[model samples]
Target: MKINMLAAGLLLIGVSLAAVNMYYYLEGTLSIQQVKMDSPLPVKVTEASSDKQWPLYDVKPSVGEKFAELYIPRLEQVFPIYEGTGTEVLRTGVGHYIRSALPGEENHTILSGHRDTVFRGLRHLKEDDELVVTTPEGAFTYKIYRIRIVTADDHSVMAPKPRATLTLTTCYPFYFLGNAPERYIISAKLINKQRVITWNPSR
Candidate 1:
C-alpha cells in the first residue's frame, strides 16, 4: 500500500509539471504569432518633387499605436514603428521618440528597438545604406552618413537638427546576455521623399 501511494504521488507531480510546461510553450508560440501579425505591410509610394511640400502631422499618435514601418534596403527587412518606447512596445517592434519631429518635419526623428529582436540585423548596415520609413502620409528615404557608439546615458545623439534627419539606435554588443552598457547609433540624412498614395489595407 505504501509503495502504491508513493508511485501515485510521483505520477501526479510529473503530470502537473508537464501541464505547466505545455502552457508556457503555447504562450510563447502565441506571442511570436502576435508579433508576426502586428507587422505592417508594405505600402506603395511615388517620388515627390523637391519643390513639393510634404504633409505635416498635426496630431500625435497615441501610445502603443503603430504609425509607420522602417525598411532597410540592405537587409530587406521591415519593422513596424510604435508610438512609445515602453518595454512592451519595444518587445514587438521599433519605437518612435514622441518628442522628436515626424518624418517630414525639419528636425530629429528618432527610432529605437531591441538589438536582439526587430533590429537584429542593424549591425550589418554600412555607411551609405538606405533606411526608408513608410507612413500613411508618405515614404521618406534616408542615407546613412555616420555610425557611432555612445554611452547608454548619452543624450547628445538626441540633439535637435536643422534639417530632416533620421536616427536609429539600439543597444550595443548585440549578443550581450544582460543590459548593454553602450548604444549603437546610426545617423542618416533625408535623401528623398515620396508620397504614399495607396495605404496598407490592414492599417
Candidate 2:
C-alpha cells in the first residue's frame, strides 16, 4: 500500500507542475497579443484638407462633450482627442491630461504621451513651436512656450492654469542611454481658432 501511495503522489505532483507551466505560458502569450493589438496604425494626417480626416476606427465622443482634433504641424500629424487623461489612450494618440480637465470647458487643456514612441518626436520642438487642436465646434491653436524637467512622482505638474493652456509630457534627456528619471514637459497656449467639420451631419 505504501509503494502504491508513493507512486500516486508523484504522478499528481507531475500533473500539477505541468498545469502551472501551461498557465504561465498561456499568460505570457496573451500579454504579447494585447501589446500587439494596441500598436498604433500607420496612417498620417497633414494639411486642413476638407477631403481628408484620420480614420478614427469607430471612436465616438460623447454628446455635449466635444472632441478635439490635434495637429502637430512639425510632424504633419492630426489625431483625435479624448477626455480623462491616460497613457494607454495618449500613447495611441493625443490624450487629455486627466489632471487638468477637458478642453474649452476649462482654463487649461493638458495632454500627455509616451516620450519614446507617441511623443518621442516632441523633443524636436523649439520655443514658439505651433500646435493646433480643432474641436468639433472650433479649432484652438497653441504656441510652444518652454520646456522643463520634472520627476516621475510630480503630479502637480498638471495643475490647472487661469488662462487657456496646453501641456505635453514625455521622458527627459532626448538622447539618454538608459531609462530616464526625469520627465520632459512642453507648455503651450491657444492661438488661432477654426470651426470643426464633420462629414456625416446625420450622425
| Candidate 1 residue lDDT tens string, 1-203 | 99999999999999999997566444322322122433554677777766544566757789999888777867756667889899768766789998998876678999988776767678999999998788888888899999999999999999999899999999998889778999999999998888888867233
Q: Quantify all predictions' global Cα lDDT against the true fold.
A: 0.80, 0.60
Native-referenced Cα lDDT, model 1: 0.80
lDDT tens digits, residues 22-119, model 2?
66444322221111323432222233434223222244454223266556776655555556454345434556754464444336777765554556
Per-model TM-score, in order, reads 0.78, 0.59
What lDDT does candidate 1 reach at residue 172?
A: 94
